[model samples]
Target: MIGMGNPRGIAGRPLRVLFLVENAPVPGDRRVWNEALTLAQVGFQVSIVCPKWGYPGFYEERQGIRIYRVPLPSLGGIAGHLVEYLIATPVLFLYTALIFLRDGFDVIHAANPPDFLFTIGRVFKWLGKKFVFDQHDVVPEACASRWSGIRMRLTYAIASWTEHASYRTADIVIVPNESVRRLAVERGGIDPARAFVVRNAIGLAHFRDAQPRAELRRGRRHLVFYAGVIGPDDGLDQLMLAARHIVAKRGRQDIHFAVLGDGDCAPQVKQMSQRLGLGDVVEFTGWVKDDRLIADYLATADVCVVPDPKTPVNDLCSMNKMVEYMAMGKPVVAFDLKEAQETGGGAALYVTADGHAGPEAFGDGILELLSSPGMRESMGRIGRQRFNEFLAWEHQQASLLRAYQTLLGYPSVLVA
Candidate 1:
């Protein structure tokens, strides 16, 4: 059964949707790319506005979606970040206004701000277009993670106010998790009824075609995989600390750990690994462009890990890696959090929140899964089954479309 707001009237016709994303090159981000593709599939004339970076310069209409990549300077650090955002906002505003003037759109969907897309939403509203808030990160929680000065506090205050405006201006706020939806209702002053929870889901079709070629493991005794950003929030050092414990204390030299993906903290993470004398056991493949390697990395592992430290952002957030690992039929071990626990369920071996759940705890978690192949198989089966039944991308599209439809006061379906 479809949930409360199924779109019964809006089928077959190509509905126009303009998606706005920040700091990301189009066709690069999995979540945004998935959203764009899905909307295109369901007869939507989709156009995306994003920054042009890396080799894929400027514009390309990929998979029936129009992309407009505006030129922006890449800057780093707090001051650099401020400049980048400051520059991006006006550029986004100018280009978006042009798009609205040129293409008659049915909807204007923008991803979270600095969650301040309300300014853009206001522009689209003036053009008689609907607005959708695709909430990916909680700006307030992220503020705590990234900044710590009075200036930071002041910036956060402005961001928070803008977040409120975005929520108030939009017809519906689409969140990654229920916790985020509640936060929008509670803090952002959005109506609970209008808030839509669209989970970060894995596209199982990609994994189905992706053959797990385990060359990275290269005849290793046991493979432990960690994929995603190499950032402070990722707790990669914790994973390293656990790897150190496994090698020195547990005397396990047979295991190999592969850390995939890149981020701002790569240099520091690499330094930490070297200092821990984990040079031999640990391997960091920074920012992979190959998709087959990604599948193999997850599929080849005896156990996959999500080592996000316990924080408000983490607790409210659902990591896509967990579901992807499950889709590849791999058991997972993660630090305890409500969303992680709920998503992984009995499919994961959770480390206790007490002090024991450190590097040693992480090591023990891996060892436990390694020791019991049957348990590993059982958890993997549960996870894969869960993904097939509930957490797949197809299951999530209804919520996504419903959020958009609701903003347009159009009917929508909840995926059953």
Candidate 2:
């Protein structure tokens, strides 16, 4: 007989989950980390299997959750992603099976960019497990945004087919925003009610007491900050161009730009920044993992910019960085994206993308925000207040619990 709160438990026992993510490791991917920890805190036995990225493969325990990191080869370009996915898929399946036996799971919560986990989820489902497809982004659109070639046509077709398959197979579909929920219902052909919208929000504990670091400001009159991935479609080049337009053409040397986070494009963006005469004014802190330090950078900054311009993937995706900047009580400037517009509320200034929303307009928006201290303060206050009231992790936690309860067939969720 299984014990109470045991993963393989008898009736009235607590629930258990196996979370699979391929894009990044747990704890590093804040959303995944928060979800795992939140579930664990609420009495679920949570086990996560993810890639090592470069770290040595090891099993560790953090915040009462078990994590198994599998090593993956570092590669670039389309072929590289494909190879990494191919290798990681089997590793994830193998490790997940081992975890299930060691610490049994009632449900499999899988995150995607590969969208290939549905096959494994299907097998588990055949064995009487429930599946949840956590949609972080639309794979086909994200692929098209990053690469354009005849070789990718087949890849895109396969991704589209797999995306629909993932949706069709899931017991419940979880999305970041309304747009993604609509995509799953309308295009992916899932039932509307079965798809849940749990928007990306900042877990307040991650930045609770973060204070400003004056050195980050670099004795500048205004500081501009950019967080999140530095991928091709992220438009950091556009930001570098804007920085050039500000420092070189506009002759505004008082503004300092801090580019945070990392991706394959960081090297190119750094090179471009140096070539464009932004060497002295622009600082690239590639992928800072310290939440406190990142929060400090956010607190010290005058304004934050979401340089991801209009794109197929970006149009629907809800960016975590945008919400995070707001959570830290910082104002934002971003391209006039529908989801960003909705997420940022009145906290952000929209730069019109007449044609891809060039750097000129972006520079102007930053300059305008920098010039008016009162407007910046007002936006920041509105953002922080709005976050506390609605956009904070608290609201998201309620939605998440409701979704889980509905999916698990519980009458109601019991808070712990």
Candidate 3:
């Protein structure tokens, strides 16, 4: 058992931490939730400021952490995103001030997609609070992947500025993987000593002894699964095209694909699935919140696919879905992404596509895995073993706590 004995501040009081999140709500954003729970478990006073995202309350306490929710507008497209950030920036600032005055905090830990939370961190830093920037995505590359032309260029320029600003403002920067840690130092020009790779991982308790339900397969002989956001850059369009190839081009009707999670491009991806005449073969479950239901879906799948295409952003960022698939003891089929390979190691079958012919190769990889149950079983065993040894939250939590230990001036000790 891992021990994080009582963590106290220099003043002999519990170190209070306030997490700033823009993209997703508290608890729904599992990484932030896990971080908060980890700190709270070790006697840190943890609080969160994030969007309500349909949760009713403006403020609530759950599992020993306090959550302050703000109702932010959900906007899309480049211009819409700009307007949304312009609106959200001030609203989040106001909420942060309210939290500061009410509960008080020692550190502001901000997670990014917008990367504009550095503005808040800067403000808090002026008020004698340390700032930790949790870099979730490479904002400039993400912008470039999502849009193009003069507008995209403008967005990319602005994103680059905010990303640099975030790196400069953060007292310590926490990244999801080593790829991003290198970017933080090289691209953002942050000091190497100030950066930490916390990794996107979950505790094994979430997946322990999960049972598959045959009914989740929908009477199909084989089930293929895809989970995580269905964004434009997320390669759902490619998945849809692959589904078309599997059912139409290959004349395979025995395999059914289930897609979980929702995002900005969900409606468009669903429309494309219909347009490609893959309605019977593909099912979209639209963001399953129930852990048991999600577990059942993952457990029932014969082969799991990470359809995130090779993009500037995708190649660098470590996908949470890939790790989740590994945690569930499932074999994966993903594009030949750098970080995917780093996380999957020998556990996943990486597919390479030439030019725009990615969907065909992706489909072939899925079919290859589906055809060989012995290979799938071997890959699954490898994945679970890897998760248990290295990628599990039990291991990653040590890095997280060590980052905090360094930040808070606690005596550094091996966490595991």
Go through the candidates in order and give each one's C-alpha lDDT. 0.80, 0.84, 0.88
Clashing pairs in 2: 261-287
In terms of TM-score, which candidate is strongest?
3
lDDT, model 1, position 337: 77
Q: For candidate 3, list the clashing residue pairs, or say none.
A: none
All models, RMSD in angstroms = 3.2, 3.1, 1.6
Better of 1 and 3 by TM-score: 3
Model 1's alpha-carbon lDDT is: 0.80
Better-scoring candidate (lDDT), 1 or 2: 2
Could you arrange the candidates by TM-score from highest to lowest?
3, 2, 1
Please report the candidate that would top lDDT against the real structure.
Answer: 3
Q: Model 3: how far is 266 from its true place, Å?
A: 0.5
Task: In candidate 1, list every pair of residues with a backbone clash.
Answer: 3-414, 5-412, 6-411, 6-412, 6-413, 7-411, 7-412, 7-413
Weakest 10 consecutive residues, lDDT, candidate 2? 1-10
Which tens-of-lDDT digit does each residue in 286-347 have in candidate 3?
A: 98888888888889999998888888899998888988998888999999999999999888
Which stretches of model 3 miss by more than 4 angstroms? 1-6, 413-416
Q: State residue 149's C-alpha deviation in candidate 2, in Å.
A: 5.3
